[model samples]
Target: MEFSLLGPVGVATGAGELVLGPAKRRSVLALLLLQPNITVTIEQFMSSLWEDEPPAHARTVVQGHVSRLRQMLAEGGAEAYGVELVTRGSSYLLRLPEELIDAHRFSGLMALARPESAPQDAVSLLREALGLWRGPALSGTVSGAQFAAAAHALEERRLAAVGALATAHGALGEHDHAAAILYAEAAANPLREGLVAALMQALYRGGRQSDAINWFHRTRQLLGEELGVDPGERLTRAYEEILRAEAVATQPPARTQPPARQQPSGPVDPRVQPAPERAQQPSIPRQQGHAPAAQGRSPGSGTTGGPGGTDSTVDTGSTGGTRGTGSTGGAPDRSTAPRFLPRPPARFLGRETQLAELTRWLTDTGSGESPIAVVTGPAGVGKTACAVQWSHRYASAFPDGQLFADLGGFGEGAEATPTAVLREFLLGLGTPPEQIPPSADAASALYRSLVARRRVLVVLDNARSSAQVRPLLPGGPGCATIVTSRSRLDGLVVTDVARPVPVQVLGTDEGVALLGTMLGHDRVAEEPDAARALVALCEGLPLALRAAAAQLTARPRWRLARLAAALGDERRRLSLLSAEDTGIAAALRNSVARLSADDARLLSQLAMGTGREVDALAMAALAGSDPERARDGLDRLAEMHLVDEAATDRYVISTLVQLFARDKEAGEGGSPPASTER
Candidate 1:
């Protein structure tokens, strides 16, 4: 049996291809195939399928698709072929050998080809790997948008392999073949400096000097117009080489002489050559139809004659490092200063205790290393808002700039990779794109080196795990890092000495204050009871309160009680608490989505069970599991802020979250008997 997601998602057997159902079903299959032998949670399926706005019945629909897929695979002799779709705790896993998946095979082949010692073999292997692509990956799947980035990354890998193959060809002196392969790719990705550089070099070596120069000018113009930046060092160097070649070609044969001798070794002037790390200073490119400037002159030193005999002195300090005939420098000031922090919310309230705790942790000097704080809570609990507000308030303490990144751990799209985050951080610190290393480890090392001794504040938001934030931490004692997540991040606390500061939902008074801030004080004061009732319905979650306030503000004539009345319905309250852009339901959904299958099932079961608090024994009865397993699942829920361990052996679920669970359980048409053990 063979599974393919490189193009249309499908299963193939020795007899024939199995009948994969509609787009949604094919999407499920594609997602499972993409990560074989791993359980994909129902929430993940729903998120990928609907892109963060799954319908109320998304879970049931996903279950139906999975069932149908399993039946189809069984009918196609899946058991005999060792291909099985198995159900686990709260997720489903597709069991298959790595060799059976084409994408996996392609990845393995690419990995083998990356080493330098086997260029010839790499060329053959890469060619074979590229041949596996039938068309756009997961093209026929319903959730194509969900896999758009993955498809693009896969295509990028293919193009990179093409580049590698061209290099191998060039190593064998097949310049024409290399140039041919690069031309198409270069044209397709016109702004790719590496591809353009490779193509330009190949063209020049293949005796197409004029064509290479033309390509350079065209690409430079396109980059300047589109990106508002000049080409990087690689492209500039390639262009300079072509220009030198052109200069030699056009010179009179009889008058031609050997090139000038190299400048004598001496103490390099600071103005002429900045520090090695600051080597990203942009060089002046000689204009076409103009006489080239004299070489070996100090940068920003003396005026030189241009094509029409005009004085052209390079301005070394021009912003973005562009050169022109001006005395002021063109290079950007504070090239290493990154301003990545997002703007703080306009009406952030509460979290005073959490903020004070974070400030204490950050200001403490005895820890002997840079301080790290993890701000964790359930979704919509204002963790991010609190972190941002505190950072802004204490921005003066850290004289250095603040760095921020949303890891997107729970985003509808693919989570941000550490390598990509490191690259962004490096660039933010004024590290030249060319200087930034390709690997995550190397980039992280460079980042630590840059931020060493700098009093910088780093905020890593929406982190999924400790591993994602670990690489981004600065090693300097003066630096401080704040991480916000739905997870408790106990690992960071235990291993990295990070102080844990949990951001809880607002108190009743605090919630009212927040609502008043958004909807005006008089309106909230005019109907205090109604406002409190609305706040109660929102469960004191800042996101929910703000959403309710927005809806009230939109309908000024509608009394606060009217809004509360609409929210009084348990079935419609979650939907009612939402406004145009903010919603309690959406925020709660993100938290629930992060739960494991068993944990999620237990949560729903508890929601359907009687009473606000459930003991371990009672939960065990509800889940039909042992007390230990039930306690473990409940503990996991508590860690996620989905439930509260109110006392010893007593757990309480939030009323709003309970509503969400009830909706989930109701959709599945199952309800455990009310707990009586407690």
Candidate 2:
């Protein structure tokens, strides 16, 4: 019997939703559902139920609640439901298959709704699984620790469901549908620009090009009014593209001209208009309307005119034209969308060509090519921010919405397994936990199918390898994806794998501009010699520059001259580059801390290796291990961004990074640097 804890408490057997007891009893059942297959002692239950205190007969009262829950489960007449809520020495144990609990079920289905599945199947499965929610998981209960955990799990599932649906619509080339979903969600959750951007993409692709153009304006207005800032550079660029009418060609209405279908029983609101053609005057020249043959759809599914064709205003949650109550036109109205994680900060300095190239690839300059781009860089060269900013810029192209996840290429713990990343991606898409499939492969299939033709942007940041990103690719064409990694994901058989853009440190001009932005341009210009010295010390690394800027921001009295002097000493440079959560030193340490013991040792040894390019054989010799061990260490270091893989079997470290590592070694009072054939 399958169970679902994703919605208002209900246990589904083959029969139907088994009614639990009263609110108290339902609460108890919900708690049990959260920890299925685990024993919850009476004391723990009571404390969770009533944190401060409980009645003298709390134990008996708990028993009564349990009894009621049992009867409710049995009411559905399913043997599995009636089977057991057993007594294990002084505690009650709930035993059921992982699939029988709603929360668990949601997780399973989310896994199933990945990028690789057939589009129709993934959409149907994701929507069905997400529909289980009546409201928040165990709504109406004052959450304690157990409820909190369950709620987080359920919310994650919800996001996964949305992500799956958004992706599916994109894959199927249904940008209008995707935009509607994304707009609704973004309005509900304004803090999540990723969703807003996704909706913007859908709008652009759905022929609602005007709506997409206006969205960034609304976003900027919202961010300024609510968040006290301008829309970031990425969002700004997307807006500029729409205004300029240079957006990619939208998925056409249909090919083969399917028979018109009966309309649903709703009046066409007068406010909506047919989506406009892309490229207004002065933009790129317009092209003749050409429709790609539809895939996967059976011959009979009818093509009705979209709402854009109707005069009715499409009320998919977001307000248009007139400013409604809580509208983005006035303030930063939160869209009714699930929040994906925020993009990495723009600590990155330069590389405009890389950004333009990425944008060009995604939009393809009216060329009818599939959209996929990969970003490659040496360690600490700022690939993640490039991907993040690029997504921010072309967000409108994918209007169904945006999805982002770190593949944990160099993060703490295990390199993020594809399955784990897919699980998170599904949640971001809005899959309920109970709906995620059982296996990673199944989840990957589902993920691909979901994004077959939607204009959603999936940013797989900090990936380790192609295997890490392969299962994550959406099957159909409408969706676009950007992956950032140290390794070159060449030779991977996927469509539109653009040439890897090698992210290097900022050039002198870009580095200086970056510093000017952080520290005052006036101050830096006043001391040109000192400014050049500071940039040199930072080695034009964006992270290091930001860290330096942050430090200077904190200490107004310290001059750039003093700061330059501190950086001149290798012993103090690492300290100068340290910031709490964001800094060159801290980021590197995080990468180091996450490594396996073997990997960590290898990194430390490799750090001391000197060369413009450190090869595997020399690295292996330094590690006192064989070629394989050395290669593994090199790979680990590359993933961590401490050392970069420059080319086949050649590794290099940034000037700042090498100095930082050297400083760290000196602080530890190491004898000498590891030897290398110069």
Candidate 3:
């Protein structure tokens, strides 16, 4: 049987086509095929399927799905040859090779469509590679965490295909054709600088000099207007060449074009943030008219920039370093503020100790290499506040502007696409929109180029996964990132360098102090017992404390004691603490609601289990898995901030979460008896 999953999940045989029934079963099959000949493990598979939330009996359900898939495969002729997709220890793996999948074919064609390939061959290969895309990847699957991630991966590949095709056309010397094709691609995906740059370079080669220059201007405008960023270096270099070539012909450049600027020999700007390790050169700009009909040449390198900003240089080559008008034509200065960015809110009381620890970490950057610290905790645990406060305090340390992006690990809506975020970032640094690359890889390169030598602080808030954060991380040693999320970024943290700092609830004293700040010493002191009870009920969570205090302050008739009485009832407590929105209960729910059914069930079981803290071993026993697998489940719980790791190898749920989880378990007829082991 020829198994396929690179694009579209399918099973093939010489006889005919094999049907992979149902979307979820197909998804499980696709995932299995993607990792052919390897076990996917139950834990990893579930994580892929549900992300954070899974239904009760998700495991049994997955098993049923997998069994159905295997049965389908068998009916489709796999049984004839004694070939079958089967479940192994913890995971399922398909028996297949690289040649069977369309994904592999696409990758193979991509490799053949290199710059050196003949025009005809390159075009053919590009077409072949593109042919593999059969609508959005896993089109049949339901919208969930696994599908979301798979879709993102597929989209990345699609963009890569566009870039490859454009490059092949450039090599084939069809500059105009390449430019036109890339133009449409860029328009559709403005965040991809590679596509944008390709179009610009093609235009320049095709002798559309004026058009190239205009493209640079338009790119700058779009980037600034939309994302507050600048054009990338590749686009900058391509436009720079157009200007220089025009100068040599003794032809006056368009009024919009700046005079041929001379290249500066030193570093660009001291305040510019550097790029991450993998970004390519800048994007290409778009011109209104004029399609040059010249042959394509190797992409030039040199000092390229957006609007008035000078792109950083580390001695790369470009089409004749004409140093033309030190900046992209008609571009804005890089020093402008983003149009829609709101001023940060002020910090409140409590978190003195946590703040100090953060400061220490900031200062500890002196230890060999700075750590990419993750501030993770329950929602409303003040993770964002702590990160923001620390960033504000240490603003002087990172002279570059503070970069912020919310990855939306827990919320809905487009969780700031990495490319979109990069575009915004580059525009802010001064890249023109037209010049931006139409590919994530190219944008990442440009970002790294821009920040290769600067000291910058990047704060990634609400990151959904390591993939989202990977592109946004700045490249230089001088750069440090602080990521805040309710979910623990296990993938990033496990990579040896990045470490996680799990933010716990405020200590008892700190919680009381925060309440004091809001209710006043006189009021809090007058109801000391009530205040203590209130803090206890809140589980010493900073956000819960603040919300409780806000509630009391809002109602003059309600005394602290009365509020405490309302909160003492577990079920009514969360309901009582809840406001229309923006309260402890709401925050916790936001995190919890994002969970997959499996995680929710595990959490409920945890609440039904023993002690203030449970180790991975205990959870594994309760969840009926090994410690390693159990840890992954626990990490998911911890990310929702439903469970806190109070001690190394131990975990605890917030007081309210504990009560709620237990109540939920009982409501669901409770979990199997809590494991006393470990």
Among these predictions, the greatest lDDT belongs to 1
lDDT of 3 by residue, 415-434 (tens): 56667667656655445445
lDDT, each prediction = 0.71, 0.60, 0.63
Estimated TM-score per prediction?
Answer: 0.52, 0.46, 0.48
Candidate 2 residue lDDT tens string, 1-678: 555565577666666666564666777776677777888888987987876778899889889888776666566654545457777776887776666665666666777776445777787777666655655677755567767776886686687678678888888998766775565466556656666677777776776554564455445555655888766655655544553454234222222333232221322222222222222222221111100000000112101111121111111111222111211112212242222324334344567899888876777636544566788765566887788777776766766556666665654324556666665454333333344565778777655544444456777777766776778777546666788876666644354455576787777777778889887899778877887888888887777777777666534556889888888887778767864334577566545555566665565566676654688988777777899878877876675556778898899876666765666566668643333211
Looking at model 2, residue 387 earns an lDDT score of 82
Query: What ranges in model 2 sit over 4 Å off?
Result: 1-349, 365-370, 413-424, 427-433, 490-498, 593-652, 660-678
Candidate with the greatest TM-score versus the true structure? 1
Model 1 misplaced regions, further than 4 Å: 1-336, 668-678
Q: Is candidate 1 or candidate 3 better by lDDT?
A: 1
Q: TM-score rank, highest first?
A: 1, 3, 2
- Model 1, span 12-44: residue lDDT tens: 888898888688898899889878899899988
Lowest lDDT 10-mer window, candidate 3? 293-302
CA RMSD per model (angstroms): 22.6, 23.6, 22.8
Scored by lDDT, model 1 comes in at 0.71
Candidate 1's displacement at residue 592, Å, is 1.9
Clashing pairs in 1: 90-597, 317-329, 317-330, 317-331, 318-329, 318-330, 318-331, 319-330, 336-429
